[model samples]
Target: MYHIPNKYYYRLHQIRPRFKNDVENVLIYMATCLSNLSEMPSDKFAKAMNNAIKLFPGNANKKDKTINNWRTEISALFGLIETDSINQTSKPSNLAFKLSENQDLVEFFKYFLFYFQYPGGYLKPHEILDYINQGILFKPVSYLINVLQEGEKITEGRFYIDKAETTHCIFNDLRVTRQNNPRKPKNTAYLVIHNRKNNINYNWTGDVIRYAGDILDYMVIADLLVCHGNKFYLNNKNQEVIVSFIENEVIFLDYIPLYKKLNLNINDVKSLNDAWFYFVNSKLDQEIFKTDLYKYLGVDSTTYQDLVLDSINEFESKLEQGVEIKTKEIGDFGEGLVLGHEKMRIKRGKREDLLHLIQKIPTQFAVGYDIQSVEFDERKRYIEVKTTISNKKINFFSFHLTPNEWNTAESLKDRYYVYRLAISKINRELHLIQDPVGLYKSNKITMSPKDGADITFTEESSQKEKLLLWID
Candidate 1:
């Protein structure tokens, strides 16, 4: 019931000069003490005046005069007139007022002051009415108060319902759009989840669903099954089990069998509702969901499935050919992709000429860098590309860097950038870490020599030799 005076009161004090000090005190007193009361008695007002006098000793002897002055100032400034006779025996008459008469002041109080004091940035209709009544007692026959109360009730109800709906299934369409890049064209992908009844749609870069243990496991399994070309499934009775998709659409699947196929314990899952709740609240899971199988693939389920299979086949074929060939092919592919991205970005600044200057250093010699590009300001960018086909369940990525590469990055300083490419069967995500040596120095990335080498780069050339460093 503690009502904080909002900016409206301060602005009113600035504009209204007459009885400004007295009116301000009266208003503060009303907000602090009488915020929940319909009316305050004359004796109570006298006590408030006495308390004020005690706080400011200069007015201790003139309390009666100050109280009379406050009464007149309140009536003159705020139109809050005393209705009851000044007799101790009779009960005080209700001081009728209406905050709704000043729409701006009401909004200022509700949105600015009341919102800060209320829990969850929301106020119930009854609390709103109480706050309004604190400033002005609405008349018995007022239609405005009723309308405001009813409107607030409807709005609050709708807000809660919408919040509840978002905890279920949500469909997200992420369109990867790049300008001036011809190698990787723009494409759209659909992220569909089989949770509860709710179906929400979003167009953004981050995850739409929250992730928890059970929910993350479930979603990972779903993506794996979808990629493995297992869309339709039957229950123990051999009937098609329908699961919720987007907006009244259903997919055929029995999640129990899917769980069994993934070797996940069915007992860990409480219910689909519980999974949905966790999925709608996890930040890490949301990121995983966004990039898992949706960012670099097709919009439809069939196309997505086909892309997954094709990627798998291509990977298997390359591995069968030779390990060295597979590594070279993947390295070349990643460097080309990154080079194209760099060209697109540079072209935005009208520095397309830099594209020709950018060289693929990995194939040329034993240089630690991969591609070399120029910034808009004509500064050099030493880029090292590391590509991986592992899923995001592995929180950290480990890659090897030659001693020459570490020395180059250390010497280049800010010019060096590590572009980590996390490639899954259906999508690929790139994360850039600038100044790898600086990152290691700042403890952002851990670095250590591989094979337990004790060689130090700062030592003489005789003791220091090229050795690989394992970075995570």
Candidate 2:
């Protein structure tokens, strides 16, 4: 249940790192400190980090209280630093050395935000246990992105999230319900954050804005969100990148497991390291692409139902006029076409129960195939859907393929398909090329050389072609 605090304020109970442009500098500095220490206890490492910050340019007189803890855990969480109880030593991780060389400011934080989660290594186990329960497991940055993506308006080409709504859901107490799809529990763990009707008080301390807003600020610095006035929107130019990232179901180990492991034998240093490593690396497993947005958002809003209508209408209107949309948008439209057809095919076959088996792998996964389905005979099919809006004649119509997709087609020869939709203001046609790699092997479709190359198919001459009238 969501508690309307004394003033509707919500705070993160964990200590957050200094989220700024120069935050990378602190990490770089910590990497330097870790260089000399092969191994050390947590307390000594903490003290060393406290003194090391003073040597940093701007942190000369910075308070020494929590800086050390932040340095250790933040670095540890992002794989920048490592702890090993086996040798009683700490070392900078390989990523730390790479970050020092690349000096990618935005990439640094993006990597961190992708993995950062609540009940992380920042606080002592007791502190984390005080507030964190099975009820409160989340990846704040991912959750923030998920919520922001919630308020996206595709028709307007705008993506903005409700500041108050997102803050309350993440920082304030809410009824979180976990429902594992029994058939695919590990594959799909559903976490629903429900909106309760009554106002209750949650004593989470710290400035609500400071706790929540700082996270949003970090996302902005990482080129994920752009702030306008009081609103937050997904960075338009970075939308493709954002789409790729928001699907990451980073894991966070639950508190109970850690306590159980820690309680067994604190003296077993290597086991302790094993447990600590698991704790830091784990995150909430909520895949954005497969999940229904409203399930997590709580309210029975039609936002979920409206996304498809808005996006498809906008895309169709643009396509019907031969106006170009982004490459990513066109790609999504193609996949949606195939997905709709798959669902319809299953329903018509009187097998609605198996409808959930069809899955669309998001672009970020770079898995080559866009949709995973099955033939009427129950044979699996991996489809790469390509949509093109061009005035090129049917004789000249062709689609580009990534090397990954082509290799996948070559590997899954019989099970692979290319659902290419050529759309123009004058007409629309769908081409289904099964076993495109086999077609190539039989010299049916010519492969043109380009970046990742394009598979050229002239409809009049190919025996492996089918006109998909059912796509409409």
Candidate 3:
């Protein structure tokens, strides 16, 4: 019941010349019977074939011979083999014949079966091309359809081309084909371009613009061009523009519009915007985007490693004024300062084990708390530090607390404190915010949830109570 293309029959004849007469009918019947099934029993398969022959009367009389011949021909030609075994009753026994280990042939038959079952439906040519590229098909089925041929007449209607508006570019050969009814308003029209050139170095900006103009006269079109391992588009000015097509523009322009039209939240837009920026700029390649442990251990696996190593040789140059330190090193130094401050404040009797008890969980398990310190009264202080190399005067210190950390802060109540440290070339400043969850609940602070972290604001808080303590 499936429409088998003439090319499939031609190819089958070329592959198996002996079973040329039986291939088409037998394959179609086999594929249709096995379409909804992973494996079919011998008795059930025989019954299905008998029913299929009655439907197609040409092979009705040779039902038994045809079924036996097809089982052998299918295995030999299409790599579908039957497994058989002798039963204890000494009667003839057979197991289900499954598709062979040949993945390409199996995929082809699967596609062919689907197409056969669904007779009339729109199947995109690019989808077929994808199948070919993915090894589902042996060859380009689109090419065999004769649709991509140059100057091929596609129906009775003629596609008018304006001579005066045509660009003097050689690659701009546009062909428009209309389906069946030319006079109908909703008639489907396909825009096909025949690129017969070998040299791809030449600029096709003018050609693209001309094609767009030609297509626009008949229909609205969004064009995509793949060239030189990059995607390009013609802007409003007819200028060729290269963009991170798949990463940024395509998803942003196509998908985000639908999301916005549906009235989605601002968080969705913000997340998508961040993702697009990160993808376009290749942010993952930088050391800052690497694992926090990698940065904490000063593991430089980037191209900047050699430059940093060379800088180490120039000790005087390294010690020069205005020399910036890495963010991780600044963070570690801040933790050291906090540890020293805690060590000095703790009772003299417990001073020996103060550093050990500080925990420094970031290096160990990357837990919510960075350091566990003891107050003057011997009470535990759970401290999470946020460090920045930027000057406190010009930049506002921002800290991110994970959901786990937020829950920890809520559970610990007054014992939880966030230390925001700003390190400049000459001086270091630390600001502490204690009982942050209580502060937020009392409307003393504001926060935004981003990427599984609560981005709490310090300067943006509208609290009358100033809980910030300046650590000397």
Candidate 4:
């Protein structure tokens, strides 16, 4: 019989870390120290943990208990590394490699936090958390997310949780501690965490609050929650992640094979990775991942369409958020600025009446440029606008050019103009690039080896235009 594992936790040892950075510093240290070593011995693991403390800001001199918790609770529990007792060795997960030096902590958490859950093997080593009882386990993160996203409609969401309420939900909420509370709203299976045995140590109240708070802080760092004081507001910008919590939270894998993989000691990072690849009848589970949750979506659970549809929807939702919308807005604004500037330049010319020819092309057309305008010489100038919003001053400018756009620019040569707009609240400026393809061919502009085009300017690099009265 398995234990009722509805548990969330953090270190309760001497040095209690309330910040995500503390965890980051530890991981960063270990990733660097262990990068070359595939299998780390126990003694080396201990040494790494000790050095990790010194790496933390202010050098708090945390020792003994904190190091142990860092290894068992945070590191293994969070799936950063796995232990191999049979071989007397431990090794870092793929995540550690990604986070090996200068990784952005929040972006790391976005991928990492998916593995964070209450009832997983993370709590298996802790006596209090792994307290034995045979019952169906619940994932606290998903239940809480539903309360945050659709709370007003659901019974639990109807109640806003402050510190006291959060404590209540963790410790005393019967809906979580018991299987079926009459008070639990109809058709809501999420609130049921486990069946109450009346033997659970209620003295875990203080520890429960600390652990629950830590989980909330994790969500905040992952940009899923905006925590103001003790209350949390859903960060609507990351609805993609929230809906993810709604979607994938239900499928519980058969960790039995994983237990065998590590002799029931290591948390099994491989198992977590395997869970995502159910397409080939993954080693952990033989059947489908789509569960009763699919009923609400009106999908025929018997079909293969679920996986394909799920993927497409995820990509589409991600595109609708953050950079895509704002990029379009900035691109439009930048093109408008350059169009006005071009009109002003051509105003006094004999072909001033040719202003009608200067028009902004809709970006969706993908005609390889943004605007059709004229130089003072009335040359047919194909203007491609690349815009970025930076509130601070910087020396360099960078942007992405699609293959089609790059080809068109190369063909047009000097007849093509690139209006690189950097807009801020107080200033709007344009660095004009005529024949960017020629500049690159001659090694005049810096084209980065990475994702986008990078340009650093000198006197001969580009023509600068100062824009004014643009905001009003």
Candidate 5:
């Protein structure tokens, strides 16, 4: 697929020593300009051209026609206008849909060389030879590899290099081959980037992402050629594949988030429950504990994925106790756990399952809905779900309560009610307490970490502890 233009190759070989840096500058400038095309402002593009012109130290002495033509071409490429009239002499004007030739890689590079060495100077033959060292070929090639690697859907994909003798079999234009020997090729090492991204479940821009395993299989063919000291011709079909590899590499280097921290953006999420974990744990960033988890979780603001992960971890730890509840009639006060081992195994679906439960809540008690689920209005009119550690004293901690349940006391007004469940080995007991805020209104009720005071409970005289009666 690679058509090495004789003219381009020849021109590159002819540059003299003095022109080398200038040519390189022009190439760099061209790259900068091309990179800007994706999101460049009209004003900035003009400035970019002006900056390129300033780079020529001896611009004042350059020939009139040559300089004029150079400026016209470059300016046109960036959508700028040239004025021959004396009236608007100094100011540059804007134009639409700049010249198309400037978009070509060869044109850009050629102009770059001219821009850098204008007054004189060019790359010497020996220097040009030195510049295209082995590593240089890999630089651009690596970009292509990176693009393909990034397109891989699996997080744990890998890459490998192989040198082997191989013969490529052509089948429907896709290069196919199998090798008889295990030995790799010489001088050519295949870099295999593998991932499950190309699996049936993943939808990808097909040519862009090659499973690392597939790449290795193709290498088997290439290995044969290298072993036999034969050069293999790459078909045109591989061109896009090559470009995608480079694109993915560049993208990964410049944009993707690092795995060490979850850059949780609360604005991206709709659920209050999802946001609550972030809001609460975001406070931990201020806590000067030895762990210093704020920085660890990548919380530039209060938003973080660590909060979600932490809540899930804590919830899972509690599952070992075999949550249970005693019947309210037996004076054993406890609410039933929504999910127990009897119904389903404790899996890594805490957040998702909880979200589902929230949605399943009767729409009559709902306040809002989004693409994924619904939420109860904060008006104390809705039931709040909470978890109790045991049925012993009916007093316990509620680690990850739904947002609606937590807010009824404040946002729901007096209608907020707490539905408490006592988890145990056998089953759970359910208890409902209405308007728990009344307890705090009279008694100097203080919320502590040991026992969260944020919850709303029933008045002392009310015997309405069985929550099932109110709903079922």
Candidate 6:
């Protein structure tokens, strides 16, 4: 004679959540008990149902209806229990002990890793993503259970993982409902589940395995790969396996932070090619592309093509794109004048970035000018700019630098009037340059390699002279 357990029903009510498979799992478990209880006396089954209802949260409000429904279902199943002859003595739980064992879970985790490594397969690692996805049962189970028991009405909570704050909440709309909550920015409940599930004391040891695998993947794609002695800086962080993979001395930590902390001098570069070679071959501990072989022996530049170069180029491109005009018109100026002002504004932003790169000044919005005019106090340099949509290649001053600019330059150390014009022809771009002396210099200004390879008098010219400014 078997009867349903109140604990199973209580767990079932907790599982009827809006997300995950908890509700379905509970139903399956309940079905098993239902089949067994059918053989028991009707009064005993009724008593079991009463006990189950008592554990539910709303039991007081709907006790009569709930109890009546259970009695009716038991009555209906009594005939089947008597005639169907099903034995549930050996099936106390819906899931088998072996199925729920840690060993089985550990095996599943391995399969998951294999699938992530090779995703075309059916049982991909993301199947375990529920363990990480936001707003699901079994996610932050410990945290949720604790909060519920504390009567905290937690509605919102957060946990720190890998240096990022991730939120945990029961209601999906809790984010919206609790918008004023302090943890809104780091409101990622998805990762909370990931950490919680991973910390489970199951037989599975997939947490460390997956963490190591992910770190290895990132390290392999690093821009300036380095491996100093284990005591060195690169692998200095907690990631031990990755530290073991590198040969020679390891820097012991990630690059940017280490670079900043060590205050490494990335200055006084002569040529981009030379600087890149030095960084890769020596400091970065990476293999350098054979520039000599490529130039004289006609070899492929495959060695030069790497993730580091690609990422660098992409970053530079983004900084370039940031120079575009966001606001169209300010006050009653024609399109030509308005665009010129915007161009100067964007150019000023680029100048600020350069200053930060050189560690000269941290402020991006330090200098300002009203309308199309600016005055440099150092040299008493007064500049008045005029712009045109035309493509004519006249003396640069003909566009913005009037004859008066020449007189102003006499008192200024480096007085400059910049003419910016859009060349509407195909393959033509906007032209801009500083006409300080109203003449081009005899020799180009050289830049250090660490300052970045491409240096231009103006943003437009910088793009044109991409190869000329690299300092080795």
- Quick one: best lDDT, which candidate? 2
Whole-model lDDT values for every prediction:
0.35, 0.55, 0.36, 0.51, 0.28, 0.26
Candidates 1 and 6 compared: the better one by lDDT is 1
For candidate 5, lDDT tens digit of each residue in 20-109?
224323332333333333334445545555544443445556665554445444433222333332232322321111112111222222
Report the C-alpha lDDT of model 4 over 1-472, residue by residue, as the tens digit. Answer: 2122444322221123433445644454455444434667857865675665454445567666665665555454445565665566666655565444223344455554554443454443342133212222444556556655544454444333443344444423434533222223222322322212332232335564665666666666556676667777676655656787666444335543432343333344333433332211112121121111122123344332533343345347657753242222234445655666666666746567777788777555688888898766656889898754332232334445667877788899998878877553334567888888898889887654222343434547788977522110
Give candidate 4 regions above 4 Å deviation: 1-21, 24-37, 57-69, 124-136, 154-160, 170-174, 177-208, 250-252, 255-472
Badly placed stretches (over 4 Å) of model 5 are 1-380, 389-407, 444-446, 449-472
Positional deviation of 313 in candidate 5, in angstroms? 26
Q: Which is the better candidate, 1 or 6, if ranked by TM-score?
A: 1
Task: Report the backbone clash tally of model 4.
Answer: 1
Candidate 5 structure lDDT = 0.28
Better of 3 and 6 by TM-score: 3
Clashing pairs in 2: 1-175, 39-89, 251-282, 251-283, 252-282, 252-283
Off by over 4 Å in 1: 1-224, 227-328, 391-394, 425-427, 451-472
- Per-residue CA lDDT of model 3 for 1-472, tens digit only, reads 1122332221111123234334333443344333323335555655554564443425556657665655544433343323222221111111112111111111233222212100011122333222222222211111111221211244333222221112211112111111111211111112222121232132335333343233221111111111122222221121121122111211123222422244344343333322222222222122221113222223336523533443354334535744554444445645654554555455344555554565444443556777898765567899887654321121333456778788888899989988766543233556777878888888766655543344445554422122221132
After superposing all C-alphas onto the true structure, candidate 2 shows an RMSD in angstroms of: 18.8
Residue-pair clashes per prediction, in order, are 2, 6, 0, 1, 59, 24
In model 6, where do residues sit more than 4 Å from their true spots?
1-383, 390-401, 413-415, 423-428, 438-472
Worst 10 residues of 1 by lDDT: 169-178
